[model samples]
Target: MPDSAGILPLPLFSSSLKRDTSRPVMLIGFQHQGNLGLGYLASTLREHGYSVLTCDFEAETSEIIESARQSKPMIVGFSLIFQFYIRKFDALMQALRAAGVDCHFTIGGHFPSLSHEETLRMLPELDSVVRFEGEMTLLELADVIGTGRDWHDLQGIAYRGTTGVVTNPMRSLVDDLDSLPYPERNFEPEKALGRKALPLLASRGCARTCSFCSIQTFYRTAPGKIVRTRKPAKVIEEMQAMHEERGISIFLFQDDDFPLFGPVWRRWAYDFVDCMHRSGLAQRVIWKINCRADAVEPEIFTAMRDAGLYLVYMGLESGNEEGLKTLHKQVSVEQNIRAVEMLKQVGLLFEFGFMMFDPGSTLESIKQNLRFLRTILNDGCAAAVFCRMLPYDGTPIKDELERAGRLLGDVCAPSYDFLDPRVSKMYNSLSQIVDVWGWIHGYRALSPQLNWAWNEVAIMERLYPGIDGLEEYRRRLAAVTKKSNDVLFSVMDNLLEVAEFDAAERWDNARLDALRREFLEELLRERDAFVEHNQSTMLRVLRAQPVQEAASA
Candidate 1:
């Protein structure tokens, strides 16, 4: 057994219920984007000889009811990763129950894993809660249920007992990730940004414990190794299978911190490149990954690019040094800049997670963050819009706020007010404008054009290499992207300036509505010009003819 030093212990019991393995199991998730956790769980259950069916959160109420009625599962497991979805999950459960498709309901995922008892109390319809690292624990539970045995002795589970709620000790982490089967992706055809895509995980667990993130708490409380990776050859073999079966060329590495975790990652990176080359999949596919700013080594990234890494996502979090420290980001602003520069040097496109507001943010710090965003925007990086830090349950930040008596609202969806009310007011005001202009207008309307342009460029680079005008086409697309981002930042700056001055007066509902309308009209006009220019450029690229051999005549 690994160290259980600071972890809490739970009551254990012996099961009295009989197991029924022949009954089907159904997994439900709000994962239109793709739920790797659910996928892994389904695969593991299937390996243990259980019939499984899945219902995405996107399914209509009628469809979900029909699926449950048809499957008549013995277990209906709900994956509740985010706390914000509790209300939705509750409504869905009520609907399913009303539909008269009764079964033993269990909930798991990040939120439920941490607050299992609270979740059970909130939704009594759920019969049990699967705790951390559920693969083996769930498998064992299935076996016990199959044999009509007692589940009280099972580790890593919290279930309603005849007396009260009974909890069990945590399970050990899976040291060898290769021991698990690849996630079941055949349930539905997956797409990302309107293109064929597959979600892949190279590793698990993050090294850094950010105050605003719950991943640290999730893994820290579990036993055994915190981070585990599959063999590079195994990873490639899975990707190769996906390529052959689904023709999926675009892959999204869903690892929390893709390139961190010490020398193990360094070795994995090298071996991954080698395996890709040996397997000959490197030239046929392009992929994206997420990592920290401090992990952006030029040499490593260059090798990654050579192995088909075209895009990267970094959690810069905050540009302000103080804000960075508050979030326990550890890395300095200089490191963030250096990371961005390294990606630029390696010719990789990147998007960033930037937090403009935090619990202790002041007006000056917000300005610093704005300046930081402008610097990155000017450098041709796409910012993932500006937002305040959310203090999630089980995160250190949430605990700190709760201890300090600053936490407010529901535990499932807690809200924190800023220390400086003016900063809060500014955020609220600017967020209103940003919601309409930046999010609805800019990102929804204009960002897709840029992504489509990049997709075209990638296709041309791979399919028609050495073709004339490729470089020119790339330059044109980059120019358009930069221009659109510039406009986005300008709008943010303008809103911030307005908020800094006449915040109370300009924040009136009627005035804000007028301002939103005006900004929307202006943004649409500017977005149209950029989209037209990009579409024309793409048409030219598509129309360009390849060099023809001399005629035989």
Candidate 2:
């Protein structure tokens, strides 16, 4: 039953706000990596009979303005995913206004909702900021705009009144996950290997309050249930529909905590596994999920693997006890190691989020983090990757840094100085080396390409099993990965030695540059060889398979 807003009685949208039903709403947001934020808002509006248009936030300003002109929507919404991109949004919106594409402009997401006044100050052209849980609120805003009524008193919104910005009372979070319509797929589905891939959500919100993460803060500040999950049957139904109707074989579970954390959620996981087996979808498709390190128990993960769980992404954010405590991760260093071991034992392909540098970082912590990465990745189980943590808006870490007077940089790119200055210099050198070889320009870089190629081989082995030379290919891929990891470890170790000795002036830039180039050349050559030989072979097997058949079939 919907409230007076003609949508579910979720927080934000009011019953008094009614749309014309025929008015078109336009949304502009980052579409990369299956952005379901805008997808849900678009779907909700469509459910209530309002036409919707979507434009990628990365599109050129002229292209976006052209889209607005062509669509002529009653209201144009912007999905601001990060506060760092505020300047980009400002310039684009300012351009749109100058071009006289004068539909109502609204922005929504973590930064805007948490700091609405600051957002308004940053992007003055925006008419309203749709605070947390925006489905109903956006629809109601559309309805009011369509009917030419005053939207000043709308709840779950912040707008500039005659005097200043007025924020309406916060709305309750949507209590039920199953009531909402499936998000509209406004873009082409992504692919894993050669199989069609899509991201699905079984739940919304996270229970943990990690200081560096905003997910908890985003859901906690809102009024309703914090971590609502759909029933197992409902989740399976969507998976089945996608598998049967859309030829999707890869399911990427985008849940913040993947509903697999504790005893209560373990029961939910078992039920979900049971449903997967009963529906026979488990045999046909492979899926992945993101969960906390503590959630990775051997028994339940084994069951999940049997039910088509292919990968697990854990937020193993830090390596040492002090680092974990600083980030408020709650889980210990031993727990993190145990979880990784458990995943390996269950035969799950695992990836992790590791922060090698943070405000609390010291020389000893840096050494410990590096050692941890080598311990995990020396065997070529997963690619070695690490990065510095940024203090994004709405996170407790950022607030803490501000209070400590340690925060540097602006909202566009929030950063902080490490407690030890030498650690900063070491990090900078490490960054320079990795940026040259690992992750600068995406596929053209070494580490990312290596990871992608490794993932492809893993997926191929699982999807099209018994392909000739597959094991040999896997062995060779592991060799390539190990070689690259060794070089990374070596380079970082040298930089750490330099930092330890305070040899700042004699940095040996030429030697490091040569090493980077030589390693990159070798890595790319190996990667290209693997792709050339194996990719087409796997594709041929895929092409030979019958349509709508199980992977093992």
Best by TM-score: 2
TM-score of each: 0.85, 0.92
Query: Mind sharing the TM-score for model 1?
Result: 0.85
**Candidate 1, superposed: residue stretches over 4 Å from native:** 1-20, 162-164, 187-195, 379-384, 436-484, 491-553
Off by over 4 Å in 2: 1-18, 436-443, 503-540, 544-553
lDDT of 2: 0.82
Q: Model 1: per-residue lDDT, tens digit, 344-414?
A: 88888777787888898987888788778777667443423556788888899999999989998896668
Error of 2 at 251 (Å): 1.0
Report residue 542 deviation for candidate 2 (angstroms). Answer: 2.7
Please provide, for model 2 over 1-553, each residue's C-alpha lDDT reduced to its tens digit, 9 standing for 90 to 100: 4435433332334555444655579999999877898889989888877789899988888888888888888898999988888999999889999999888999999999999999999998999999998998998888777778888888899999899989999988988878899988767777766688888899999999999988899999989989999999999999988887777888899999998877898899999999999999887788889999998888899999999888888999888989999999999988999999888777788888989888899989888988888877878766677778889888999999999999999989889988888898888877665554434235666666667776666577568765567667667667767876777677778788888895543335466556556766766676566566666677777777557633522
Among these predicted structures, which one has the highest lDDT?
2
Write down the RMSD of all candidates, one decimal each: 7.6, 3.7
